[model samples]
Target: MMRRFEDARILMYSHDTFGLGHLRRCRTIAHSLVEDYRGLNILIISGATIAGAFDYRARVDFVKIPSVIKLRNGEYTSLEKHIDLHETLKMRQSIIRHTAETFEPDIFIVDKEPMGLRGEVEETLAYLKTRGTTLVLGLREVMDAPHLLDAEWKRNDVMRKIGQYYDRIWVYGPPDFYDPLVGLDVPPAVRSKMDFVGFLQRSVSHDHGDDHRPSGDYILVTTGGGGDGAELIHDVIHAYQQDPTLTHRALMVLGPYMPAKQRRKLVRKGSKIPYIEVIEFDNRMEELIAGAKAVVAMGGYNTYCEILSFDKPALIVPRIVPRQEQLIRAQRAAELGLIDMLLPEESADPLRFAAALKALPSRNPPSVNAKGLRLEGLPNISRIVGDWIDGRGGKEPLRVIKR
Candidate 1:
């Protein structure tokens, strides 16, 4: 068992190289923790290029790691320097370890990846294990399908690592809909450390007033990161072109990482439709989401949480390559009646896309009342982490406070 320390000095590691999911998740959890425990101090370690864009609370701080790019060939390379992929990954891992050692955090919460920054976290995890510091693994509710996850989990030795090092395995999604650890071959002893923490969502106080001139009820098109979103964006544009009566305006936000040539092509195509507006990137995405009548989006974890929290009707087009996590999330959300998902084959069909878009209601459907979704666990996560430091364990009841 990991040794417990008293009080709060927490370090959260989020390896968000391209998109906002990991960073956003860390931020949400940190915000909840600080609000629940006024004495807590949080230091977020993220690799996002746009980390500065977010507004954080007083007790929270950030460390920006060098950015990396996901190439068309499904490979990743460092963006800031011309280094071998192996070398880049090694360098990043070294920095992550150094930061952890120097900071000496009482509790370390690692998001998704077990090894961290290409296994750099292994060094820190080893050091923390020797020092008897608490270590927790934070996982999203849905990872991928059983078979794929089984293969990847074994290959990465994630189960072994979790069983060996982690004191707690906190799942950010409910167990009823999906258990992230299923099929991972976790032993019963290690499984005892698992806790389902419910979905972590950004809480926006009051709707940011809908100021932008409605734009005649247009469909908002967004790909979390346009790296793999080219096909989806093209399909949406084609769908719009095929049906002249579709009548709705189209606002496409090409993610910052999309290739320039591809973006230019989309811009030229969008020009053909007087009602379609193509923007390279916009910081005010939440504003755009709020202004839209319906949303057409990729099924990234962060996007799923936003759609649920905003309570908007959405058509999720998930990416199935590199990882099947998005597809699983979209399918699960659809099954729960939280949102609509377009199958990979149907995503390209103009009629099918249009029909799905047209079928979406303007509001979210009512949800089933359940213990898991009470959002009672958010504050509890904070309390548990704090109490864990103070030598507490097992399940504890959570209290909710309105801000």
Candidate 2:
């Protein structure tokens, strides 16, 4: 039975490792919850350096833990601090547990990471369970390759934790498109609690980036976080350099995590080209996407969501490194005729990239007949949360919109 309370609180954990996807998704949910409920409070625990970049809603604030970044070789390190990995994880664990005990939220949302980084949230989850706080595990639509994910989860015992800790498993995507847990052999009990909330719809805002907004119909190229996007950036620039007559103007947002030396080189090369604009970072990415003719990007979750939401024709060059999540998503989307894809191995050739860029303007967006496509994740999440708070067990049916 749901309780009737005028005021409620939510505490969400986002294990920020590579990009801003986790933090951005949580912030969107936080904003939605605060807007719907009168006296709701949402607290996000994140490690994103750019958490302060966006303007969060009232009653939605974040606690920034010491930032830790994942490197190319699958090792972890503190982003900008002198602290060691062990020390940083310990500190983060302490902060997370302390916040949960003090906040005493009615609901707890864990993003992506099952037990948090290095199992930091286990103790916290145990503590919250004892208090009867509603626990939710939120996952992206598609994780990584089934084999890879299965092994990783097995090592971490994620399946066991899912059964023991989570009250509900919220997959932030429609099941008709892709099931993030498909190959993991999810137990029936946990599967029954899974909610296929539609993809969160991103609002278009011109409130930001007016001064630096690119003029004219240009192709926008971006790599979420730019940590491993240096190759993508170079490829786009090479495409422009190779095909000088390619009339499409290009604007590239090299993510902030891009290496300084590499960024300098990108800027220097772009300076010679009148039609290309290179920026280090911009918080108003949606507005930029809104103004673009088409998109060329890596297949990060947030970027892909924004691309689909805006209905922009996109050519994805997904990474196949530490995780195949992006590559898997891009391949699936391609199969569904949603976006164009250039495999990582194929992206090395300048001519192939140039050809793809030239063809982007004319390629049609995803076919309207695409099945089970749901992009209204924000309002759906709000409604589900509202039901939970109102003690109404009934859920809103998944909203499926044609692509």
Candidate 3:
């Protein structure tokens, strides 16, 4: 009974509390969905300060809510000092509910946060559930240290709420790669709703990399969103200062959120190093990563995907504070021989970091056996969505390359 289902609307929510990771991930999926289904329209409700900075497709649009920022100590506050956190949360909740009512999305997808930043989206989820709109929860391949996540959820009864509201739970990675809920006491029902869609792959539209890419092979160092990235950048610069023989030209991107003072110091110091180049921010990260000989990054989910998609050798310096999501991911990926990892303390050692950078360019890129690595999230999502819309109910995922 599959119909010709040509037209549909999908609404996505991204509570970008910290960096651009949530918003970027949503945008990537939104673009892919629209590209696959010509008649589909996607509306993303985002809390990113620079939500308007990136481009969107013809049918892809976004609604910007008041931005909220997360501090290193794991607390959230209004992005604007003048606005009270309580009032901002109220405004965000109201805006989300109103948008959901107006959009009437066939599918409602919430990224990461189960209850949406202090349970702001709880009411919307209930409303959508009553309306019979397909409610989906999208999660990163790695969440956080299990105990930390478990305690946080237990305090709010988030696991129970997820089961009650969501019809499906999409973990954006292959099941074998990692289980986001491994240590949690997830009920059988919630477990059954889980779908391991593999990693979301990245692609560059065109090769505009000539401008930034080095003539000879170089390492591209990037910290997604750059709020907690100053430490990594400082380490890299110090490594170069310590090792005069490290000749590989390094291109570093200071993400938009990095403090102005830190950025200036890094720029001034990096300028003295003939082989190092520092840029403020570039939306074309895929291009830079693709063109590089290797990558040095803080290993955010998006950066991890980019590393695999581009098949570049990478050195991941995963952060351990606030949340251990990056550390956990880096550890797993390193264990699987997908990437090399260094702890923050280890990476801070100028000599150790310099040696890693020197070896990075010549190291082998990611290569695995048939059951090794897969990037099938986008295609599978499109297929399942198409099936749902056409009344075909395609629950199974499409296969990836055998290599």
TM-score of each: 0.87, 0.93, 0.95
Residue 142: error of model 3 in Å? 0.6
Q: For model 3, how does the per-residue alpha-carbon lDDT over 1-403 read when each residue is reduced to its tens digit?
A: 1223456889999999888999999999998887777788899999988899887887899999999999989999998999999999999999999999999988989999989999999999999888878888999989999999999999999999998989888899988888899899999989888888889999986434356444776799998999889999999999999999988999999899888999999999999999999998888788789899999999999999999999999999998999999999999988888888999999999999999999998777886422467798998788778867765333333433211
lDDT of 2 at 353: 85
lDDT of 1: 0.74
- lDDT by residue (tens digit), candidate 2, 226-336: 989989888877777888777688889999888899999989988888878898998878878877889999978888888888888999999998888898899999999
| Regions of model 3 farther than 4 Å from truth | 1-6, 207-215, 368-371, 392-403
Alpha-carbon error at 138 in model 3, in Å?
A: 0.5
Clash-forming residue pairs, model 1: none
Clashes of 3: 1
What lDDT does the true structure give each of the candidates?
0.74, 0.84, 0.88
Better of 1 and 3 by lDDT: 3
Winning model by lDDT:
3
Residue range 321-373, candidate 1, lDDT tens digits: 77778888888777777778887789889988876766665546324322235
Clashes of each: 0, 1, 1
Better of 1 and 2 by lDDT: 2
